[model samples]
Target: MSKKLNIGLVGFGCVGSGLYDVLNRSNLIDAKIKRIVVQDPKKERSIDQSYFSFDINDILNDPEINVVVELINDSASAFEIVSQALKKGKDVVTANKKMLAEYQAELIPLAKENKVSLLYEGAVAGSIPIIRNLEEYYNNDSLTSVEGILNGTTNYILTQSNSGIGYEEALKSAQELGFAEADPTLDVDGFDSKYKLVLLLKHAFGITVAPKEILNVGIRGISEKEVAYAGEKGYRIKLLSRAEKIGDQVVSFVAPHCISDQHSAYNVHNEFNAVVVEALFSDKQLFYGKGAGSHPTGSAVLSDVSALKFDYQYEYRKAQSNGGLKYTTDAFIKVYIGSKYVNAIEEVAFYSVEETFQSAAYSFQVGWVKLEVLFDLNLNARKDLSLLVLPDSIQTEKGLSELIEKNLFIYENQN
Candidate 1:
């Protein structure tokens, strides 16, 4: 007969409402929702209105509320709520990746100083359990690289486009299906994936970097020609977030990549997410699941609540170790560039040209190039051009081509 844990939930949006339903319907965890804070009290909700409160203090200042779950969309408000909760010596759980990515360095230490646990398993790659796995199981492993398809909205749009639907139509369908928002900039423009990548870097490599410090390119400018080229070459166009350790340097970038079917991420489509972790001894391990949606995200939040009962918290082992890993964009790699402006393609000096194609609509070239040069170009900022994808054949300065070779082997070995 364990005592029930009291929870104060903020934000009764999709994930928040879903969590309320989940907690009410299940006896899996001995937890009760004590108070829920929302911005608007007049807003219609299926749940009992008596459980709702307009003031955040009702939950934060309440000594009986031992746990606070912040699911708000506003990062500033979320930061305030989470910080105050931790300061009050109450455990905090949140699904706000943006806030955590931007202020984790401060928030993590605050939680530690107050001796309160802070958990956000729902923040990145929803329902994948990646954060917990990284903080726990792979804590001792020497992780070399982590790459994945992290955004569900873009993935769903890409999946639809691959099926012969136009990009605009696919996006429209995603919005209608509630997979995307009216303003899909965050998801479509790579900001969502960028935030997730930053979190992954923290847990996987103990590297903390601002989202802007990493190269984040989205699929906004991708055309049918580029998609067709990928299909013709036995490759799938997937928006990929990748971080790799080369010697003492750590390189991370998010962009659309032309991955072959042999790659684990090739088949991940339509509101799904997948992460591939490459470690020293384990070789490669893949984690796949639904990236978003109310129920899946709510399930992750509930898991964190259950974990709190056992005093579970992130160890942050890599951050404590003297890993000497520094962020760098100087790594050499292969890339595909498509643009109506040929001068854009010719702007940089390439190491080698693998393939070239031309159509009335666009001209594309595949070649080897320095990552720094591409970062400097910032092709994502140019409306006239699209940086299609960085292929798996990328080579670094230290001549570590084993990943490419292994990828090829996997492709050839596949039935």
Candidate 2:
């Protein structure tokens, strides 16, 4: 029989204590939790830590500890903890999604060099195992489309769309349920799904574009009327985190889309999440589960711990692996970036629609739109007058005619 692995937990907050709960029940895996470490000494006094230490050095310096679990929330400092652990040849299992989302570009390679597994099962969809599924099961398959209810807070907020409740009331309900943090800007503003998308890009498609590159849209602007209209039309409005390979470009965004009963993700309500994958071989695959919860998320971290606890034997003897491939963002999807920040400025001598934004361009899309720009020499010079700069693609007479027909640029496009 194999011996139990010695483990260390970094954060003793909601997630850290939950990890201990899940590990105690794993019948197949035996682990000796050596110590739960903390950076702040006050935590040492608050919690019973016969095996706890305030210094990080205690975990790294210990010769018996084989794996370190980082449940810390801060991305910048958590990065340091995981990196230092790898340098010392200790495997790492983390539930810190923000750190991985922001720094997976640099961290994955470091894990390979040290021959230590950096497993993040709790990052994407709680305990649903989206990252592991993409890395292991979808190795040979080409994933074409990805759409999911990635944010629990936003989902709970928008559930009120059907109830006729306002945004403020919905947010209060979410806060009471503990689905949202004290500062809900990250989840409500779409930064949470943006980070999860980065993790998906790294593991599933092997793309490591910066979070700033992808277009992010939150559900805040969606009005109550929009939700009611969606139901009236036999459809539902959901805040979707999506990444699809459109030819040579990766089209990824988070927004509320109108969907009918044919869509599986529309049925994923509340804090439960779902991912719809359009694979080349298999027509479609749906992964659904609780996207966030103390116990569920902690169980996900335990899965990673189990993987790391036995990874040494799996790689050498069992031929077991989470095989991940690498490819550039352009390899699978073309990034549609307009050189000029103008999508509209069509001068038809009579009509002008795109006179709003001259500073920034809009996000990429699959739909079609056109708007004409009427040049008024007196009004064009002023910044507020709406004379947008045009690129060569829409500078011609024929382009102006098309722009007048579609009338797309009158409203605000994705910023």
* Model 2 residue 339 CA deviation in Å: 28
* Alpha-carbon local distance difference test for all models: 0.87, 0.66
Residues 52-141 of candidate 2 have per-residue lDDT tens digits of 777888888888988889988889989999999988988888888789888876787788788888888888888788877777677777
The superposed Cα distance between candidate 2 and the true structure at residue 105, in angstroms, equals: 1.7
Residue pairs with clashing backbones, model 1: none
lDDT digits (tens) for residues 1-415 of candidate 1:
3445899999999899878888877888899999999998668988788889999999988999999999999999899999999999999999999999999989999999998889999999998999999888887789999999989999999998787788899999999999999999898889999999999999999988998888888888788877887788888788999998888888898888888877988889899999999999988999999998888999999999999998778878898883688888777778888888777777767766767877676787887778777778876677777776656544576573565567668979995
What does each candidate score in C-alpha RMSD? Answer: 4.1, 9.4
- Candidate 2 weakest ten by summed lDDT: 330-339
Q: Lowest-scoring 10 consecutive residues by lDDT in candidate 1?
A: 392-401
Clashes (N, CA, C under 3 Å) per candidate: 0, 9
Clashing pairs in model 2?
A: 248-333, 248-334, 249-333, 249-334, 250-333, 346-373, 347-373, 355-386, 371-403
Cα lDDT over the full model 1 = 0.87
